[model samples]
Target: MMNIMRNSKHPVRTAAKEASHERIVSAAARAIRRSGYDGTGVADIMKEAGLTHGAFYAHFASREAMLAEAAERACTESAAIAAEAAASVPREQALTYMLHAYLSRENLEQVERGCPLAALGSETARQTPEVRRANTRYIKEMVDLVARQSPDWGQAGAHERALVTVATMVGTLLLARVVDEPALSDSLREAALKHLPIA
Candidate 1:
């Protein structure tokens, strides 16, 4: 028997739908960072994507599904940015460059475009498992990235050192963003940047 549905698939329509899906995910990614998961609504995401609210169902099964994808997108972006920052310097200085960039004033104020872990880590803990899974996957990738930049990349304690480095960076940024006092925020980030055991 012939498969009618398979035969009816249109490449152009598929491409267009894929583009729309990208737009929706991108918008949701920014929204989640800007507004947090609980604050991001379907209607706003759709509107930001320039999509009709009715078109959301054609892409995702539920809000949580979309949020999961969005979280993944944001994390991927954060990893890429960190990689770029590290790549711009020498091998020995890669970790230092990345640390400086992450703890910089520019990243501090760019919540919507900053690292998702620092921006949404606390909120993610209370989110659905699917969303947490997405974040966890990227968090592991980031830890590996830091480990690779270490002088003892393949050594025993490299992974543990990377874990502590990531934790400190995220914690520093999180607290920097939490305090209303600009001086305190600057101090928190500066202190972390100074004391981070980069190699």
Candidate 2:
């Protein structure tokens, strides 16, 4: 079957258009990562993406649509690893990688485009119901992926773990970026990872 949605009024994601759209979405993701959804404006996203403001409408109906896509994209980025990270280690180690990746200084510094949780959690709370649902599904999937390691764990177990992981990461990154000192930033990473593999 064909992807009718892919070929909607939106231009084709051909070799040419694909790169630009990817750039726009990735740029917007990065902006949201750095500036927060409300903080990052369309023009700023476009400029950061290296495209002009006029081109954004062609890719998305509005910023929410972009955020929706960004949320999906961010989840997609983490989903693959969620499985792989858990494969070799016990459930907790996998959790460490998943949570660690999100809360690290490397992630906070990148901003503009990193973990969706750190980049857009608050904004997502304010999003349209549809977007919120999408985010919910993404979070559930990630939780399930981690819970897989504990064959005995139930849905509630997975759900709570996922919530803790996502919350830990988001809060850590938020505080990490807020501080002016490098040690403070490293301290946040250490604090978040304290319960994970290293500690």
Candidate 3:
């Protein structure tokens, strides 16, 4: 039955389905970041992608499946920014540049376009295993990327420090986003920059 369905799909139909799936995943990524995984709904995602609610099942088996894909998509973009920053700057200053970018006021305000680790970290505790697994993998990817760029890459405690750096950055942003006052928010970000090992 599976083979029959695969063989019956025309090339054009396959391409169109792939395109729709991409659209749904992209929309879910942004929506989940902005509104959260629990807050985002299939109806809203489909509508945001300019498709009907009924079309969701055609693209995804379940909400959790879509959430897993969305988490992976968001985390991939987050990792890319860190990796690129690490590559672009001088070895000694690579982490500094990445830290500055990660803790920037602009990044803090642009949650929908920013790191999934910060945006969805707390929420993932209540998520499915697949979603949690994807988040964990991407987080490790970001940590490894930063660790490799460290001056003491292979030395003892280098990876631990890298993990702390990533955690501090993400935690600071998450705290900054939750505060009611703008002053407190700015202070949180500044404190993270001042105290974090971004030298």
Candidate 4:
């Protein structure tokens, strides 16, 4: 009877722990995007999650583990946003709608809540293998998402076109963020939008 009673409490404890773990990951995801991987610290993430620093170990094996999960979360969020943008319009206009959303003024200013590829791509090369793997999955997923939007999806060159499209979008956004001049930034985005091979 005692053992049964004790075991019953395990589920409640596990649920609480899972909730805390989610909070940590969510906070870490935002922090990484807002501050970049090298700029984010475990202590800051824990504080952002409203937990004590010492409690971090209870949720993750190491800082790298937390970072890896955070990277995955950020990627998942960006992908969802892209999917939502694509879905908001008619099927024929999905790609254009998604492209506009990706390069919009709102996305340009909302780095913390925008695409991880544009915000973290430069820094990802220096990150740990685990973090890199998380980002790689996102890149693949984003490419697939773009390819599916192609009118010639499943054709020979569709995947290649998606590669170019994703690259162009990411590159355009990255450059737009780099320049301090607002006019130049707008021009860069405008050029990409005007020239992107939309079908």
Candidate 5:
């Protein structure tokens, strides 16, 4: 009788715990992006999630564990944005739509909630293996999504073209953020949009 009672209550406890865990991860995701991965503090994440810092151990094993999960979540979000844009446009026009959206001033202005690769790529080299692996998986997924929308999907250079596009977009966005002058930043974005070898 006691065993049956305990088993019945297990699910409710598990669901509540999972919900709390998600909240922590989500908070970590935004925090890391807004304040670089190395800058994100544990106390800030828990406070953002409306939980005590002491509660962090319940959701994540350690700081690195939270970072890996947060990085994964951020990168997944960036890929999803590109994927959705690709799906909405005609096959031949998909790449154009993606380029427009990715290079837009709006995306550049929204650093906290924008592309993780643009925000964290340079820093990830110094991160743990788990964080690096999560970043690699998401980057591959992004490249694959771009390749699917390529005009030369089955051609000799389709995959390479897609890789170049990803690198250019990320590099351009990074440059856009670093320059002090608005004109220079706009120029970088415009030049890429104008000259990128889009097929």
Candidate 6:
């Protein structure tokens, strides 16, 4: 005799599994924001999600897998910010606003909850090949997002602008962290902001 299987209930189960997977990814995002990829261990991520370390493999092949996903999430969030910055009333104004927002004191103090470049950009190049690949894609997407918003600009213009934006934002944050001085930090951030192509 042959048996028939039901797939309706199966869909619901699949949804539940997907929800759990998202939960794990989100937990990793939060932990990574605070401790960064290398500093955040699987046990801590699972604990943050109120889960067990043993259960992690059910969602990811390894900690590296989790970092890859979390890194993408973090970078994706920054890309969204870039897109929004580009969407401001005037295209040129958008880039300038993004420049200011990205290098602000608020963003600098919250390293984990900030741009992956600012949080882990300098180190990402040294991670596993998979991580480096993921970071590269993340960066290109961010540049594309910024470019998409300012069509009044050409590809060369957009490319140069994106490079400048990323470089300034990354440099400002690193300096702020290294000097760890509020006055110097705020001034450096303003100096970067002052150089934007705001109109």
Q: TM-scores of all models?
A: 0.93, 0.70, 0.92, 0.95, 0.94, 0.85
Model 2: per-residue Cα lDDT over 48-165, one tens digit each: 7889999999888988888777767766765665566567566556666666666666667776555566566577788777667867877777666656544456767655665676
True-vs-predicted CA distance for residue 74, candidate 2, Å? 2.6
Clashing pairs in 2: 30-112, 30-113, 31-112, 34-112
Best-fitting candidate, measured by TM-score? 4
Write model 6 residue lDDT over 80-157, tens digit each, in one string: 776776676576567666777778777888776677777764677767777677678877876665665565455688
Candidate 2 regions with alpha-carbon error over 4 angstroms: 1-15, 87-93, 155-159, 181-185, 196-199
| Model 6 per-residue lDDT at 110 | 78
Full-model lDDT, candidate 1: 0.92
Alpha-carbon lDDT, every model: 0.92, 0.69, 0.87, 0.91, 0.87, 0.74
Best candidate, lDDT-wise?
1
Candidate 4 lDDT for residue 79:
89
Q: Write out the backbone clash pairs for model 3.
A: none
How many clashing pairs does model 1 include? 0
RMSD, every candidate, angstroms: 2.9, 5.8, 3.4, 1.3, 1.5, 2.8
Clashing pairs in 4: none
Residue 149 of candidate 1: its Cα lDDT?
91
**Which digits, one per residue and each the tens of the lDDT, describe model 4 over residues 1-199?**
9999999999999998999999999998988888998899999988988999999999999998999999989999998999888888988899999999899999999998888889986899988998888888888988888899888998868889898889999999999998999999999999999998775
- How good is model 3 by TM-score? 0.92
> Which stretches of model 6 miss by more than 4 angstroms?
1-6, 147-152, 155-157, 196-199
Looking at model 6, report the run of 10 residues with the lowest lDDT sum: 1-10
lDDT of 5: 0.87
Segments in model 5 whose C-alpha atoms lie over 4 Å from true places: 1-5
Please give the lDDT score for candidate 4.
Answer: 0.91
Return model 3's CA RMSD, one decimal.
3.4
Superposed Cα deviation of residue 192, candidate 6 (Å): 1.0
